[model samples]
Target: MARMRWSTSHTRPYTLRQRRRGRERIQALEQQVAELRAQLATQWVQAQPTPGTRLDTLLTLCSALLVTHDLPAILQLVVQQAKALFVGASGVLLFLSDTTGQMLELRATSAGTLPPMRVYPGQSTAGRAFLAPRAMLMAGPELALALDEQQPAQYAELSNLLTHWPPVSALLAPLRLESQRLGSLVIYGGSRAQPFVPRDLPFVQALADMVAIAIVDVEERNRTTQLASQLTQTQTNYAEIQARLDTAQAQLLQSAKLAAVGELAASVAHEINNPLYAARNSLYVVEQDLAADAPERAFIAVAQAELGRIARIITRMRDFYRPTRTELEPTCLNEVLRATIELVHTHLRHGHVTIQHELDAQLPQIVAHADQLRQVFLNLMLNACDAMPTGGVLTIRSTNEPGDASAASIVAIQISDTGSGIDPEHLPHIFEPFYTTKAQGTGLGLAISAHIINQHGGCIAVASTLGQGSTFTIHLPFTPPPTVVLSMYSTLS
Candidate 1:
């Protein structure tokens, strides 16, 4: 009995020791399970992007769309952000080509440099996604089948492009805004620790929407800019056309006025000439009849001189209507100018005016009427003297212009006076017949000068500044036009 009791006591203590060890093992196992649960939670949280992070990514893309206009730059930004959004994934952006809407061109990629690639609708993954209504997650056999259906040439090109970073799986989202389908955004998964799944579609689709909006905005802006430029050019053209019409109307009016004045002057001069000659002859006879020492002799002489002056005035009026028949010759312009200056030197000096000559030494002689040119020069110089009554400088300049493709070589003469400039309102009418600013002026000088220049197939222009000075420029060709010369001869004959 004593032996049985000792065995029972020893076995019970050993059983208690084993039970304690088993309880300790259960506690250790519980701790291991808790640690495993914590690790799983951490992995799950890391696998999915946080709501705040996704929103920030979308906002950043929206900001890029608003500010940036360059298509490639925006595409690159989209692909980069897409790659960052999907862990262990590369990205590609494809768009319909501007030249061919049927083909999709690879624009940007996160996978470094690749050869140019194009895909046809319904023939490749990107193209199919463009036609699809929603995003697609393709993998394994589906991706291979899509590639195998492509034309051999396209397959080779796409294969070459994909070799840089071959995709194990692909997530595609069509870039669409309402009814408009632009292209596709593709996220390619290689040998990634976390593979793409169906849940990733919404994020990629949102990004694709951003890309579409950006493209549409940029294209619309470019179109608006081009239209504005065209509008401005059209307005400028309209203004130029209007100005040309105004100038043509003014020239037509002037030509009509001159024709009417010429007819009237010719009639009046013809009527006066016969009576003028009779009066002059009668006065001369009376002067001859008077005795040399007679008191009436001096008065008779004065009457003869006054009748002669009247005849001269009538002759000038006739000449203005029908220019004197003068043949065009190779006239030395310098000689004509020098003689005219000599005749007007005392007149200009009396008005306290100084004359300056800036003649070209190598000036070529032109075909012109020397006498008519002398008349024009004398008239212009006298007018300049009249303008500068209180002393000023009169500058006469002559230059020989070289020929060009559009125009022949020509001679340019400028007569400038530092005097009270012409009133802007009067400048347009200064060359009109019987128009005069001076109180006692005959007003035929400038009109005759302009007519003679026009008959020679040349042009005269005047520029003046208020309170400054005036310059009169004459442009004469080296040779007069055959038509103009023939017309002049016909008129004289």
Candidate 2:
């Protein structure tokens, strides 16, 4: 025998072969273990909450969404429900962006102490998901490493959130509505929290979808509220316009009645003039023929006086029925107003009424028929005196006022009286022919005044308080109608 000394070399082959076999077995065992681990992970993912269960929870959340009209409350509830679903998540953060997507904003977060943070689409996990509009996840050291890789200057503010609550894992999903990503939702799991598996992603995504729907619902509701308010305002404005139109139509009808009355008065005045002249001549002859000492002379003188009064009344009727002349010229309204005041001074004195002038020194001249304007002012002053009866103050003011876009400017004339104001029920009819409240009034003064103002391309408005006083405002544009100017020029030529 070669003895034990030869044994080291002689058994080396067997030892090497045995060692190689053992190493092969070990590698095969490791491969089987990795395959088994993969299979187990797949089964664990499949073992997550059933579709029916997810559907039930989703339905419950949707019911809550339907009743909850508040947007912030809905978002809070969504995050809270996501925390509950994961069972061990530390908190959730919601990042929303405007329609333009220029800037991302931190909207809501379930974690009380988590500092707010925002990132652009190319930066962090939240941003990446927003770009892809897909779900993403990171666990433990991997999340920390990714965050650290970001530039120190740009991500300095973001470091505090990670330092304060270093999550063991995080899951994120984009909140999308029909291919448009509105924002992203992030769920953070603490060190002791359960890992959020793949199956849980669907549930999280569903929550995100619910959030999208809620956002749209709230926006649409707000829009509807605004539209309703606008519609109500429009309806109110339409009612006001309709009321004004009705008033204008009534005025037009009254004007037609006045026109007819004027025609009748003109015909009647023509018929009465001849008879009045013959009667006046007969009275004069009778008075002349009577004896100087005869008692019949006094009777004849009284008859002549009565005839003269009748003739004066006929002359007034003729003036009232005369057609208005269309000739207009630029005339100073103050001069016309003063002339009118002088004519009515006697009547004002009898009524104990005082006149006050507030004429604007810089008041520009306006295109007008001076004679017609003077007549209009005379009628207004006489009417004011009648209204006072016991006496009061009359104020006349003039000023320049801005006009509409198409007009250059306007001259505003205001006549105010401190007297017993017209009754509200009677005010509207005051400008109608024969609608006077006075016992001896013909009721044609205001109607004729209104007609004259209208012919001048002006508008008149009256405001009265039953016991307080009354004010009549006249707005007249500075320029006259082209036809009036042309006709005047033609007549002059």
Which ranges of candidate 1 are over 4 A from the true structure? 1-37, 97-100, 112-114, 156-168, 191-193, 276-324, 330-366, 391-414, 423-444, 463-465, 475-479, 491-493
Clash pairs detected, candidate 2 = none
- In model 2, which regions exceed 4 Å deviation? 1-57, 112-117, 139-164, 248-260, 292-431, 434-493
lDDT tens digits by residue: candidate 1, 1-493? 1111123355445578777776777777788889999998899778768767987989988997799998778888888788888765745646554444687877877655545667876657888888889888988889878767767876666555443345678888888889877888777776555678777888888888888899888888898989999999999999999999988887787767677667777788789889888887887787787777889877777877877756655654565656554567998888888888898999888899999999887889998888778878888988888888798999998899989999899899899999998999999889987789999986678988898788788988899987778999998999889977775555543
Best by lDDT: 1
TM-score of each: 0.76, 0.53
Question: Cα deviation in Å at residue 449, candidate 1?
Answer: 1.6
Cα lDDT of candidate 1 equals 0.79
RMSD to the true structure for each prediction, in A, is: 7.4, 12.9
Who wins the TM-score comparison? 1
- lDDT (0 to 1) per candidate: 0.79, 0.75
